[model samples]
Target chain A: MTEKKVYNVAIVGATGAVGQKIMKILEEKEFPINKLKLLSSINSAGKELVFNGKTIIVEEAKPESFEGIDIALFSAGGSVSKQLAPEAVKRGAVVVDNTSAYRMAENVPLVVPEVNNEDIQKHNGIIANPNCSTIQMVAGLKPIKDAYGLSRIIVSTYQAVSGAGVNAVNELENQSQQFLNNEELEANILPVKGDKKHYPIAFNALPQIDVFQDNGYTFEEMKMINETKKIMHDPELSVIATCVRLPFFTSHAESVYIEVDKEGVTVEDVWKELRNAEGIILEDDPSTQSYPTPLSAANKEEVFVGRVRKDLDNDKGFHLWIVSDNLLKGAAWNTVQIAQSLIKNNWLQG
Target chain B: MTEKKVYNVAIVGATGAVGQKIMKILEEKEFPINKLKLLSSINSAGKELVFNGKTIIVEEAKPESFEGIDIALFSAGGSVSKQLAPEAVKRGAVVVDNTSAYRMAENVPLVVPEVNNEDIQKHNGIIANPNCSTIQMVAGLKPIKDAYGLSRIIVSTYQAVSGAGVNAVNELENQSQQFLNNEELEANILPVKGDKKHYPIAFNALPQIDVFQDNGYTFEEMKMINETKKIMHDPELSVIATCVRLPFFTSHAESVYIEVDKEGVTVEDVWKELRNAEGIILEDDPSTQSYPTPLSAANKEEVFVGRVRKDLDNDKGFHLWIVSDNLLKGAAWNTVQIAQSLIKNNWLQG
Candidate 1:
């Protein structure tokens, strides 16, 4: 193997929750980086974050911020990414965006390294990360698709409030306290912060995650629907999603029903494939009361799947329960994996 | 129509969560009650419960507690129901059990009132109540089963901890606080209190509810499997369940995948049936962001269902999301409905 050369790395939105996780993941992976740059909004420019025993000061993100930066990771917000991503690309930095800005764009490569690593080479300056729910579903289903072709997916998600950003997390805490104390709750940032009305998420479930689309599906649900087709590269594939926010802090759980193309596939057959697949940890053992849970999957990098079984009547239908830390595999780690793929494939320099 | 005569009613396990809700339902429905007796364990005896502007003192439940009682409602544990239910029946009372003691017994009719109200007339002195999860599933599916035959059912439940009793609710609150403050959490009553190991349910999901059975299904899952057959009166129907306890307090949400025996049935067909079905409120308007959530259904009596769709590839398959207050429709309201049926049908006479 050729000797590795260190490259300059830049993280846009370096002060947010997913941004913080990206910083920690970069340190944990010990990525070969000659220099690190942290960029955020002007209001948060003076904030300090320590990484690799060095205090890094955050700076305002602008086109000039990408000078000499080989890789740019963006997670601030969709609008921020829409404004700064192309600008960073114009400065010769490859962008791995963690927002919906370019995910469905015809030109952007929506990637999950383990599922579609080769798709990274086709990126035109920017690569899109799939939604957290979409990422875990595709990761678990990819192997199944490879073993037996997939035709349909019906998913109901039990999502964490952290996916709405840090403010919603605080709102869950505050509203939960108010509910416990029998005090009136003030709701500002649940369901969708920009939506017309707010619903309390403390000890409750909100069927709406993002804003509602014209089709009656929430933006979050549509993201899973569209992103699954894009990531799996099967527009003909049928998918329906109902995303609900629960009172959890970290991991997202999904009840997924899938129809495979092959016939006579048994639960044993699916379990065998999952046990041997990469980046997947199968914890399904009904005898030992073993299965994946949000708390157990939190802070873990692997996609945990359990409660797998074949449909009782349909020979080809199957059900799975998939869980993963939304911030890690869903956002930060997936972004870093794409960056690593870019470096390995020599796509970053272009 | 002949005049309806008021009958005596008794509530076992009074002062408990479900027992309190039963009292509320009875008061709201203004059920014909010439006398109301409240019975509880010795520890809760002498407690005063206010219903309809009258204070009823809780008496200690015993084998002789049902003497002179006409209609007896039991929400106590299975062991307590096993010991006292037959005694109540022997003393000229019609016992409606909300426990699992005689649910699958040969002679006892497991009733949902809406689904199998006529089956209540076949009860040999005692009528068994189905599991909370099973009750909601059967209620939603019974209508569909009547219009279109059901071949198989696969459900994954997002259950509330309050189903485990009051202590589990307290444990969830305490653990949530400990988790938020980064303090060490101690789980004492979740994932089956009698089991050797306990897992924290706050900010977590426990895959196992109740204890495990010989067939690798938890007792809760087995209850759903066996009870669905008993209530639907279709032993040939295949049912599988994965019961999970979430941090929520009262409502239970289930993702149900079913295969219909008839072909070419669209989602609208099932929706039409549910829209006119009694005891079911169809809250499924996706465009305006209207769907049944646990918070909205927490204190409600109806089983709320939405997100109904047909499987894209399978002509016989469909998916539905069912949500209901476990403490109400799943327990208390169902018990009260049975009581009303008893008096209306004149089955209360010994």
Candidate 2:
């Protein structure tokens, strides 16, 4: 075996939901680390987080924070990622950003490990973790695309409030309490926190997930549309998305409809491919009532897929229900996986 | 008005969720009822329901209950409707069935008032109310179908627990309380009460709305498929549905994708048609963050539609978000509307 070189890892926004998960994942994964740094926004500085049985103090992230870092895992807001990703890269740290800032940049690779692990090698100092919804979808689609050259995809997402951040999760809890008590529910941080209007997500389904683009699709929907093409390396693939925020707290689920290029593909064919795919769990026997709800997929790392069936009207069309812990496989795990891929493939140096 | 005739009306399954809504709608519409009868299953026969300041005692429905009734609105289970609908018709009363018993019986007309109110005229005795999801979707699609002529429909529903009836609503309440307290959830009803498995609906989504058929689609899905074809009077229309049960108390929302037969049907063109469509509220203004969530559309009678956009890849493909009260427009209001149509068109005497 080759001599192991440990990484000096730093986590940006270490107090956020995805950030906390990253710390726990790095610990659970037993990744080799010479030193671990916890960095957060100014407001979240001075906080203490326990990692690997040691209490680490979170410091304010600044220009000099990335010094002596080998891999910086970022789950900070988009503005923070925009400001610090390049600075970290310039300091010789490879960034696996969990924000949308660098995802579509031509030089940055938007990746789902199962779908495009090779893309990680092509990253220029920084790599992007695709949207939570996009990561689960691309992971589920990778096997299908390899078996039957894809044509089109139409997806509807049932996303958890955790994707909006910890504040939205608290809002869902508070609003649900208010609703159960027959009191007036308050809405502050849901659907889109930065948008002008906020909607209650307790026992309600909001069709908008992110700020809407001028073309009428929300940014989350557009990310799914654009990022799927990039991750699959199929620029001509037809992708459309409708993303909705639900009351769930952890796992995000999607109802996907796809038209494959191959005509003779059956449900068994799709199931066989999905069962054999990396990082996918198939819980799909209809007679046994086997399927994955969001609650069932929570705290798990793999993408859970079920309810695979052929379209009644279109022979080439098939439907699948894909679910995953958005904070894990969708964000933190994918980021750390990229870091691991970099080290394993000896592609760490710029 | 043409010498108003007070008809004798009976409400079957009068203790049910939709049946109670039918009673309220009848009182609100001030339908000239000469006599009112409330009927339920033997288990709930002695319950009391109030209508127009009078407490009406619910009685067990038998074949003889329709002897003096002019119109009967049935929201009972399918077996009850299958047993008594023909009997009520034989006893000289027209039955507007809110069950799925005879929806595709070839002789019965599946009616959505805005889309196919004229179909009520051809009812020999029992006119079928379409499925809750189907009713809202077809009502939203009516004007577009008229303007552009639709060829195909693909819908994924976010249905409230109330669509499963009172027990499901109670289950949601119980499961929610259990979830909030961090206790083990005991789910006795949901996603098909009689199915082998019961999944908790609080903060979770069940992709199977009803029991799975041999083809892997749920009964609720097949209902949407068969009923849409029947209500549209088009046997050739391609339709597919994926029905899911959500945790909301009322209102069913759908993410609908349609292919219009006419070429170059823009979003503005579809919006123009939807603006004038009867019983439809056009709520699509993404710039203003105006859209209909389940909570916003809960108590309303009209079908609330928003998020209308043209698919980027398929010019003929248009996506719509459709929502309406499952108890009102979905079942009860549509049934009441058919009864009023029967009275208005002087087709009451079968």
Best by TM-score: 2
Docking class of 1: medium
Residues B12-76, candidate 2, lDDT per residue (tens digit)?
99988888889999999999899999999999999888899999999999999999899999998
Give the Å error, residue A48, model 2.
Answer: 2.0
Fnat (0 to 1) per candidate: 0.52, 0.78
lDDT of 1 at A331: 97
lDDT over C-alpha atoms for residue B136 of model 2: 95
- Candidate 1 lDDT over A96-116, as tens digits, reads 999999999998999998888
List candidate 1 stretches off by more than 4 Å. A1-3, A261-269, B1-4, B46-57, B144-152, B236-238, B257-272, B308-319
In order, the first chain's TM-score in every candidate is 0.98, 0.98
With a 3 Å backbone cut-off (N, CA, C), the pairs that clash in candidate 1 are none
lDDT of 2: 0.92
